[model samples]
Structure formats: C-alpha cells, structure tokens
Target: MDPDLPSSSLAVVLVRARNPLNVGAAARAMSNFGVKDLRVVGDYLQPLEAARSAIDAAPVLASAQAFSSVAEAIADCTLVYGTTALGDRDLHHPVDVLRDAPSHVRQNPGRTAILFGSEKTGLSNDELSHCHRLLTIPMARGGVSMNLGQAVAVCLYELHRDAPAQRNLPEPAAAATADDLDRFESLLRETLTAAEYDRRFPGNMGANETRELVRRLGLTSADTTVWMGMLRQVLWKLRQAGR
Candidate 1:
C-alpha cells in the first residue's frame, strides 16, 4: 500500500453478501487494518445486525453505504478492483496477484474500491465488467474458496502489513472519479449514436466498448472534465445539424 495514502481512502465493497455475521466480520477486519469505507451492493439478509459482529468496528458497520448497483457504489472511486477465486470463467480484465495488488493500488491516485462478491455466487460477469482489474488470492491447489469475511480480512491484512514508515510523501494526483467516467462515457455514447457509429456495429457493441474504453483510459479529474465538455459540444452540434 502507498505509505502516503491513508487507509481511509480505500474501501471494501461487499456485493450481495448473504450473512450479517460476514458483513460484521469484514467490518472488524477493516477496522483492524484502518480502512473505514464499506459499501454494500444489492440485497442481503439481516443487514442491520451486521454491527454485532463488527466488535470494535461498530462505527464502520454503522456508516457502511448501500447501493443498488456496483457502478453506483464505486461512483466516486478512481481505481476499482474485483476479487475472484480464479474460477473457470472467462475474464476480460487483467489479473493481479494478491501480493502485487498493493503496489499497483498504491501507484494509483484518488479513492480505490476493492470488491468482494456474494457468499454463494461470486461477482457476476456484469459486475466484473466494471472493475479495472481482477485480483485473486493464491491458495493451495484444489483449496476451497475462503469464507467471505476471512477473505476480506486476509486481503486487508496484506495491504496493511509491512506498511512503509511514515515520511513526507507526495500527495496523490487528482484522478477522475467513477461518476466522472460514467458521464464521459454517456456523452461519448450519445455522440457516437448521433453519428451512426453504433450502426456500424451490432446491438450495443459500440456502447459497451465505449464504456470499457473510458475506464481503461484512467483519466485524471481535469482530463475527464475537458473531454466531457468537448463531447457535449459535439453532441449539441450533431443535434442541431439533425434538426
């Protein structure tokens, strides 16, 4: 983890976790490692009692944010990583080993969100599509996946372990938030549609590719703002021309 980056800037996101105990345990782990942000996506059982298992992490549990979608939950984050068990499913994002993830994360600026999937089924393909990268915790061959809470704890521990000694660290750059990226993608998609770019592709292929491309660009805050303005102007002109 970047010594300059505060753990508070990191968020642990639980997606459709079914157990309140697991939620509490994850919160406890977050507290143990100094990460304070927790975001829950989709429906879960006994969400309110999650604090009981949080122990001294009650504050974290109490303040956990709930969202209807993974994209919405990470809207303000700049870097998003999705955890997986390395199942046989096809993946589009680059995979990062647990040990190497901390360094990659520390290299990025602004808020970072690490996502854990549901207890029964891990992150869906759609959910994974939103991630900039995939992370897999190495385990013995044929080993079963760790419990949701345990997995969260292990990942957080790795990020917190051997943390660099405090020093005058350079401040992180202002990266574009997920929401900013979404806006840019939306405008770009609209402009592309108005220009009949999608007609050249099948179904929503153009739109989906545009979304993925926007994320891959990893734009800074200023870059996003400038692009949004440029795209909006183009879209406006296109609309006028069509009139």
Candidate 2:
C-alpha cells in the first residue's frame, strides 16, 4: 500500500450488478489493493451471504453502500470513470486506456469513483452519462470480454502498482464533484434552452452536445462555479430580453 495514497479516497462502484459472487470478488480485489470504499447501485440477491466469497475482504463488503441510481452512488466523487467494452456503442465521454488511468487518478486531490457495470449488458447510456471519462481494459483481437472479477483486479492492481514512486508527484487541483458538475450542466442546459438553442436542432442533439462539451472540459471546482454563475447570468439576460 502506498503511504501517500488514502484508500478511502477511491471508491469502487458497481452499477446494476446482478451476481453477488462477482460483487464479492470485486470487494476482495479492492481489499488486495488497499481501496476501502465500495458502493453498489441497484439491488442484488443475498448480498451479505454471497459476499462471504470476499474472503478477508468481508469487512469491505459489509461496509459497502447501496444506492438506487449511479448518480446517487458517486454524487460526492470528484472524478468518475466508467468502464466499458466499447461494443457497438457511441462513446461520448473521452476514453482513457486502463493502464494510464491510475496515474491520472493518483494526481487528483479529490475523491474518485471507478464504475463497473453488470456482467451481461455492461453500462447503459444513461449510466455512462454520469461519468466524466470512460476506461477500457486492452485485450487481444477477438478476445472475450473479461470477467467482472478479473477486470476489477486488473484495474485496481494498476492503481496500486508503483504507488510509492508516484507519491512525489505534485497534487492536482481539486476537481469538481459529480454533483457540482451536474449542477453546472443543468444550468448550462437551461441557459441554452432559454436562448432557444434547442429549437435550432431537432430531437436532443443540442442537449447531448452540451453534455459532451461539459464532460470534455474536465472542469475543476472553481471552473464549475464560474461556469454556473456565467450561465445563470446569461439565462437571466435571456429571460429579461424575452420579457
């Protein structure tokens, strides 16, 4: 374990995971890597008993928090990374190779959450919407999707590996929390709508572009506040002009 890395600052969030065994295995991996926080979104059967597979990680499983939605699960995390296989899906979030993500995560000063989806379908577009970035584990051509447990182990191992050397790196600025980013997005959307930007494009194209733009910005806490204030002022001006 890296003396400089606080296990509590990293959270492993399982979204709509159907198998309790896989969940337990993930917890076990977290224990191996010294990451202490575990969060589950959605329900699973007999979580407590199945978590016995966590071995010595039973305490980690025991302390896991449950939420009804992904947004709720990682609300406080400053950085949210969603894992995906990139199968026949349009990726709006910027993709980060799994091997490189750990070092980027290590530099961040705020809490980070790594989200993994269910075994069968993986993360849906709605769940992906809550993430700031996407990560994919590299494999051979035509390789089968990695098992949930194994994927968790590999990702956490990368994060834990060579932590001591990274300890000396300069700390990154405090990034915006998921909730803060959400608020900024909401305000930006409202401003766009107030300015009738949505009317120019058919369907949700405007809103979707707005979301992608926001995610790509990778705003810090201060950036979020500034954007929110600016958007709100624009919205007010739009309303005043309309009146």
TM-score computed on alpha carbons, candidate 1: 0.62
Off by over 4 Å in 2: 1-3, 6-8, 52-57, 164-243
lDDT of 1: 0.83
TM-score of each: 0.62, 0.62
Instruction: List model 2 lDDT by residue over 27-118, tens digit each.
Output: 88988788888988885545534665455555788788888889899989989999988766887989998878876687778899999988
Off by over 4 Å in 1: 1-6, 48-57, 164-243
Compare the candidates by lDDT and give the number of the best one: 1
Where does the lowest 10-residue lDDT sum fall in candidate 1? 44-53
Question: 188 in model 1: Cα distance from truth in Å?
Answer: 86
Whole-model Cα lDDT per candidate?
0.83, 0.82
